[model samples]
Target: MEALVLAWPGGEHAFRLPLAQLELLQGATGCGPEFLLNKLNLGQWAATEPFEIIRAGLMGGGMDAAGAKDVVSRAFDRHP
Candidate 1:
């Protein structure tokens, strides 16, 4: 599966990823704040709080409205 990596507006890192990539990362280091942040960018969420992002991820795992929101939120927060 193709993976997308998007970084917060100014963040050095990138977010956005495919399920396969997510799974790979999970196997490696588990879900850390950084990983969540990256996913948030991919989803295009609009919040910064970890819980909010987590919820977004859960709701948007399928890459629906919720997931987009989470990704945007992460990007917005990271944007500097």
Candidate 2:
């Protein structure tokens, strides 16, 4: 798959990233989806809008596997 791209302020440089990298990019580089979107003043994508859309966005199909278990456990580790 193609690596995703992330840019720095002023477009000075960009990094090619993966979806999995999102798990820790905010802490490591001080630039993740939330910060970048808000910094750019494009908060619409920072989180789902129109409240009603959020539920469908967060819902997912079942995955009965060890990795799936880890994922479910981690969701509880996070706060709403």
Candidate 3:
């Protein structure tokens, strides 16, 4: 599958959500991926949604666990 490249505070990173990651995301958010997508589209997403999505996507895109968490932390600190 194609990856979505996103620019974080540190640098650009490729993000993807395979089935496994999506399942994890759903569990984390207590909602399905479709509902999350809808919330994002309508600009009504909770703060944790973007964080969870980005972290999961980064992992799915082959980033190491530490690296993904660091990137998300720095990015959200600046942008949030």
> Which numbered prediction scores highest in lDDT against the true structure?
3
Clashes of each: 14, 0, 0
Per-residue lDDT tens digits for candidate 1, residues 1-22, read 3323433343322234445545
Q: For this target, which candidate reaches the highest TM-score against the unseen true structure?
A: 3
**Tens-digit lDDT track of model 2 for 28-70:** 3456656654755754443312121111112212223343334
Q: Per-prediction TM-score, please? A: 0.24, 0.24, 0.87
Computed on alpha carbons, the lDDT of every model, listed in order, comes to 0.47, 0.34, 0.90
Pairs of colliding residues, candidate 2? none
Please provide, for model 3 over 1-80, each residue's C-alpha lDDT reduced to its tens digit, 9 standing for 90 to 100: 99988876777889999998999899989979999999999999998999999999999988987888888998889988
Q: Lowest summed lDDT over 10 consecutive residues: which window, candidate 1?
A: 6-15
Per-candidate Cα RMSD to the true structure, in Å, reads 12.1, 13.9, 1.4
Off by over 4 Å in 1: 1-62
* Stretches > 4 Å off in candidate 3: none
Q: Against the correct fold, how does model 3 do in TM-score? A: 0.87
Q: Evaluate residue 17 in candidate 3 and report its C-alpha lDDT on the 0 to 100 scale.
A: 95
